[model samples]
Target: MYRKKSKAFYERMLKKYPDVMSIPQMSKACDVSSKTGYKLVREGRIDSLKIGRNLFVPKEYLISYLLIRDENNVR
Candidate 1:
């Protein structure tokens, strides 16, 4: 479960990504493996969209994942 952080917190990712994007695309952008991306989605670490058997991720959720990960690593 992710919280609704400040809008500015997500501004960077929101600018780099579309409102929604496929896992493959997001993975490429993040320079991670598609498997890792899928894992994140499946594990519920990143919110996702299941549309007609295809999984998509919203930019906001991706931003949430990135921000959270960055915050954790900075500690």
Candidate 2:
């Protein structure tokens, strides 16, 4: 017999492997556009690192930022 996975399992997986994402991946996951993601970086609302002209967002920071914004709307 096959078993079904639970929402909690996916949540835990996301939390455990947040770093396994890119800007496009994040845009899709967060329901935002790539342009908006770039704007957020430029506005200093989110943390990012530059490697020659490429920008990388830390997964933990992204997750925490979204969670804080959702909880307190501080941004």
Candidate 3:
């Protein structure tokens, strides 16, 4: 059986590495497309810190948001 990652799993990763997360990393972690992630950042659904032309999202916040949204799915 395939096991999906939990919020705690991501929390641990964040604790281990506080550095900025790249778009590909975020996409894999949140199981979203890079485009979607960018859209979320633009819409303020997800928080991001920009450095130069790059953007980074806090792992904790991203994981939490994904968990909450998954749990609240209307369908």
lDDT for every model?
0.80, 0.68, 0.71
Give candidate 1 regions above 4 Å deviation.
1-10, 13-16
What's the C-alpha lDDT at position 58 in model 1?
A: 83
TM-score of each: 0.75, 0.67, 0.65
Candidate 1, position 8, lDDT:
85
Question: What are the per-model C-alpha RMSD values against the true structure?
Answer: 5.4, 7.7, 4.1
> Model 3 off-target regions past 4 Å?
1-6, 9-19
Cα error, residue 45 of model 2, in Å, equals 0.9
- Shift in Å, residue 15, candidate 1: 3.3
lDDT of 2 by residue, 8-63 (tens): 54456467445746666666666789998888878987788887778887776676
Return the TM-score for candidate 1, rounded to 2 decimals.
0.75
Worst 10-residue stretch by lDDT in candidate 2?
Answer: 1-10
- The candidate that wins on lDDT is 1
The lDDT of model 2 is 0.68
Lowest summed lDDT window (length 10), candidate 1:
1-10
